[model samples]
Target: MNKFNMTAIAVAVGLIFSAGMMAQTMSKDDYQAAEATIADKYKADKANCDSQSGKQQDICIAAAKSNKNVAKAELEARHEPSAKHDYDVVVAKAEADYAVASATCQNKSGNDQDVCMKEAKAVETRIKADAEAELKVLNANKTAGKEYTETGMKEKAEMTEARQEAATDKLEANYAVAKEKCDALKDDEKDSCQDAAKMKYGK
Candidate 1:
């Protein structure tokens, strides 16, 4: 129920997710073993969640699911390290974070909850946008990296465009969170808040 406890659960799951990503190419036996390990971990996580009640339990369940999802995605990333798979890993991480954030927001009410949800969304958006940019950059790097061929030039351009678009997406998400916070204010204050957000984000 406490913030630190929830955060610890999230961090613990995330650490496992990170470690899963570092796995090298595996033999059939190794892959199966890892797969089994993931399954066992998920079961253990779920069992731990069973000890809590109500909203705390829901958050625990969400965290457990997040852990399982990220583990699965990381497993695939390890099994096949491609732009698409790597992107999947990032997506998993984003979703995992969002799940926990959304669950935690239940602790708040009214505008506080709204802001919490919006902030969660902003984080998700940034992560997903980064994933997209990273995937595009990886695809672009499929070309002659660091070498100045015509194709390389095109690849570099694509990479730059992807990153720019991701940055724009992040900015827009931030603006949304700012605007959502303005909802807590009244009339002129709210209007000024929104105006400032628009100016800050170039919305």
Candidate 2:
């Protein structure tokens, strides 16, 4: 791939994985339609390559196949969201790129061809490594999010318990004051006052 195309693919891969976390499964009809569309498109693309010859034909065929494979992987990832599917998309992209690059390398001769093939392999390895790293980072973020939510819940429960204790303490203090006041009242009135305080404080 050229610099511009590689950059575009990188950006796309990032967005795809980001969205993959929340992607819902596609409807059966939609999935089937997409599959049919991909098949038709691949056939048309391959037919276009038939006019070419030698290395040109190889390159054209490689490009057609790569595009098809990548599209199919992307479709699967969208239809069934999972870490495996997302990783598969990345793997498909790497393989597709390597296929194109290898085809291109065949146009060269001698040491030049060897060097080209090696370079293509290196690029494929790098892309695969990058994909693996991205997957690891995504998983780490997911784990961190879950831990944060659990911590928040625990803190909220503690706060609620604290509030209840504070309310109980206030009621007990008020009841003590009410009972002291009742002590100054005479016999029957004092008993009635204490009863009222007890009921009011839920003692």
- For each candidate in turn, the TM-score is 0.83, 0.64
Residues 4-95 of candidate 2: C-alpha lDDT, one tens digit per residue: 55545556666667777688899999999999999999999999999989999999999999999999998998898987688789888878
How does model 1 fare in lDDT?
0.80
Candidate 1: where is the Cα deviation over 4 Å? 1-23, 144-149
Highest lDDT model number: 1
Task: After the best TM-score superposition of candidate 2, give how far the Cα of residue 77 lies from its true spot, in angstroms.
Answer: 1.2
Q: What is candidate 1's lDDT per residue for 1-203, written digit by digit as tens?
A: 23453344334433443354455766778778889999999899999988899999999999899989989887787886555766777688778878988998999999999999988888778767876776687678878498989999999999999999999998988988899899999999989999999899987
Q: C-alpha displacement of 128 in model 2, angstroms?
A: 0.8
In the order shown, what is each candidate's alpha-carbon RMSD? 4.5, 29.4
